[model samples]
Target: MSDRMRMMVVMCAVALLAGCAGGLGGGTYERAEARRAMTVDYGTVESVRQVQLEGTKTPVGTIAGAAVGGVAGSTIGGGSGRTIATVLGAVAGGVAGSAVEESATRKRGVEVTVKLDNGQLLAVVQEDEGEGFSPGERVRVVRDGRTTRVSR
Candidate 1:
């Protein structure tokens, strides 16, 4: 492919990878979660702390990047020079792609500690979106299997 075509492919790949990132906010729910039964408990927010949620590190991004890079690099030179360029491009692309994926998937979150009406203390971490939580505020702790979230 031409250099321009290769560049377009790379851009499209990056866009696709970015679009694949899903939100973890309390307001966001997986399709499988719909119609599922969940448990709810009342509690008072004891504390709220801002936190950073790490992003996913899947091979899809790295592979896609390497492929795009190799294609782009192949257009650089001839013979051994071209081979070297391809390898370097693939390596650089892989690293950049991983970083991009991580940055794209990362989210702002909060660690909320709540005191249940029964005196049980619990802490839940979830993406910080929609209703914000504050100390001494009444909230609901919703649980679906291993997943838990705090909301008003």
Candidate 2:
């Protein structure tokens, strides 16, 4: 074969080999499902508490607002007036920053309850899902010291 034809054949062989190696780990994940005989229970929310979530201090809106307000305020006056303008601009920027932060930090409450199989209930408010239990669902309750894990 010519030099050009020989190079083309080699490249084609390499490409075919790469393609064959690409699909080696393509398979389905299988989990064994089995039923265990245990007690199933229910609960109710006794009280709800408002919580403030921990989040990033720097939100896009706060940064954008500060930038725009600073530019606008700094341009509003000349000389000493410009100094006053910048200070005022910083105050406005702070207010805008806080508003943005508060909105971002707003938290949602998850209701946690302890239920006995004999229809008793106790509720608590927590940021994390307590025992991974949802409303009106059957779960396997594993009890440890001051904590629980609800499994299906």
Candidate 3:
């Protein structure tokens, strides 16, 4: 690949990585009216476990990787040999790019088990934003649509 083309691909990859980091982060909640606000439930955290947060895997990474890889692989040989190398490189690069995007965007999170005031027990998981909830600590559970969060 030409230096110009390589530079373009690198820039594209960097842009995609920045975009992949979008969406929810720790310690932030959407603001809504009282009626629209999440329904609140009270409980005590019974246990906590650290966990890995999954990042979104989009087609951008695969496409960028394939483009770059194909160009690089095309330099390997002539005609049919080049074609075969390009295909293999594209596939391998696509997979590697997807994995890299996921890892780079992943965040640290925690799973919390709680016991409700009504004797019903529950567990919730969320990003740990320095608001660590220990066992037996009082917590409030809130639900907005299908998403729920636990807070002090």
**What TM-score would each prediction reach against the true structure?**
0.92, 0.40, 0.82
**lDDT tens digits, residue span 1-152, model 2:** 25565456445433433332111110211132124333434344333344444433444445444544555567677989987886777668656754655555444444455565666665544444333445665544443334333344
Q: What is the C-alpha lDDT profile of model 1 across 59-93, one tens digit per residue?
A: 87787788787887888999999999999989988
Candidate 3 residue-wise lDDT, 58-129, digit = tens: 887777777777767777888899999999888888888787788778888888898988887987777777
lDDT of 2 at 135: 60
- Candidate lDDT values, in order: 0.85, 0.47, 0.78
Q: Residue 89, candidate 3: how far off, in angstroms?
A: 1.7
Worst 10 residues of 3 by lDDT: 25-34
* Candidate 3 Cα misplacement greater than 4 A, ranges: 22-26, 30-35
Clashing pairs in 1: none
**What is the overall TM-score of model 1 with all chains considered together?**
0.92
1 or 3, greater by TM-score: 1
Alpha-carbon RMSD of each model: 1.5, 18.6, 2.8
Q: Is candidate 1 or candidate 3 better by lDDT?
A: 1
For model 2, which pairs clash? none
Ranking according to lDDT, highest score first: 1, 3, 2
**Model 1 misses residue 116 by how many Å?**
1.0
Model 1 clashing-pair count: 0
C-alpha RMSD between model 3 and the true structure: 2.8
Model 2 residue 99 CA deviation (Å) reads 1.2
